[model samples]
Target: MTFSIVARSGQALGIAVASKFLAVGAVVPAAEAGAGAVATQAAANLRYLPQGLALLRTGVPPADVVAGLVAADRERAHRQVGIVGPEGPGATYTGEECLDWAGGRAGDGYAIQGNILTGPEVVEAMESAWLSSPQEELDRRLLAVLAAGDAAGGDRRGRQSAALYVVSPGAGYGGGSDVACDLRVDDHPDPVGELRRLRDVHELLFGTPDPGTLLDLSGELKEEVQSLVAERGYASLDMWVGVENLENRLVSGKIDPVVLARLRDAAPDGK
Candidate 1:
């Protein structure tokens, strides 16, 4: 009923999951820095999240955490869990008697897990998606992998909800919302599609803006900046022109070729 990707970023960890079950996001996903990520599914016991995080807090490795959980849980054989730590420690567990189509993958900085799923192909596809993709922002890369799982016959029960969470480096709890992105699809006919829309919105606001700087300019430079801004796609060069730090550049009347290249990249395709 759940498929998730738990991953470690530069200094943070993230978890993203989707399932036909309600609140699946809450139960199947957990993450913590200095520790690792955990996904407990298939007759999941929610306590595993806190316990796993606590173990991680004590500097327990991912493999050890999985071992500890199995030893403690009376029903460990019936449970399915996957873990990946900051140091790249990884492990996967599947009870022999799990409801079929249950398994997982553990890698350098990520774990892909699912159970009572469509089939083993679901886990295979998820892992493939995760491994084949190039490194990128955890949010984008993780979601891309999840979407690929859906394309590969995700949950047999179908989709209902999903969410994504990532902590920022040096951010305290409730620290000015260091959560780079937090989104949930509580209910949707197309949760993944809605997730993509929301992620796109997130990128527009938080992703890098096109290269932009201001300078006092001569006739031609001023005209060029104005034209770029008026073209309906480029950022207004005037926005930075008067700034004290950038004043020198503006006064130069000619943009540096390197700077112009950056701006062009940002506004490529006139976007």
Candidate 2:
């Protein structure tokens, strides 16, 4: 019922997921910065997420938590799970009673799990794609893995929703917003594809630019700026500023006397 990426940042770890079920997020995953992440699915026990996270917060290992939860659950045989904890602790559990072909895989840094899926091969494809995919940012890499799973078969019942989230101390997820990107496709023809498109827009706005923001000018910097814009097929300050999308209030036809004198004094040639 869920697919998610859980990751650590400066002082936090984030968990993001989506599913057809209502508030599937509340049921399928848990994450903490110093602790770790866990995904419990297939007749999912929603309590496991918070309980698992709490155990992890106490420095318990991910495998142990999985084992403990399985031991306590009477229906453990029908469950599917994936866990990754601090320092590379990872594990996956697929009970025999789980619906046809249900299973999961755990890797060095991630876990892929699914149930009532098209087949065991679906989870296998997810794991392979995640491991072999070109190295990229966590969200992008994760989307690729989910996309691969879908292509391989995915949930036999069909897809419904998708989500993405990341937590960082200062880096904005998109366009300087404090929250890194938090997006959802609750209902879509191709939910994962839609989420991927949103992530692309996030990168365009937040990703580092190929050409750095640089400013260089000859003669009086302000005047040179003015002159350069005018030479660039613009007629006046208004036209230059308009083409550059600079606010008009920041400049005028005549520099204020004080500002003009300061610029003149600062200029090497004292224009």
Best by lDDT: 1
TM-score for each prediction? 0.74, 0.69
Candidate 2 per-residue lDDT, tens place, 184-250, comes to 6677768778878988866643454322332233357657646544455555446543343333222
Stretches > 4 Å off in candidate 2: 2-23, 168-179, 205-271
| Clashing residue pairs in candidate 1 (N, C-alpha, C atoms within 3 angstroms) | 214-241, 215-250, 216-250, 216-251
Over 4 Å off in model 1, which ranges?
170-178, 208-271
Candidate 1, residues 1-271, lDDT tens digits: the string is 7788887767777777888887666678777656677888888878888998899888888889989998999998788888877776477788877776878888787778787688878878877877777567788888888898888888888889887776655453224555667778888877877888888866543443223643345687667656765563435664433321232233244564434443445452344
Alpha-carbon lDDT, every model: 0.72, 0.63
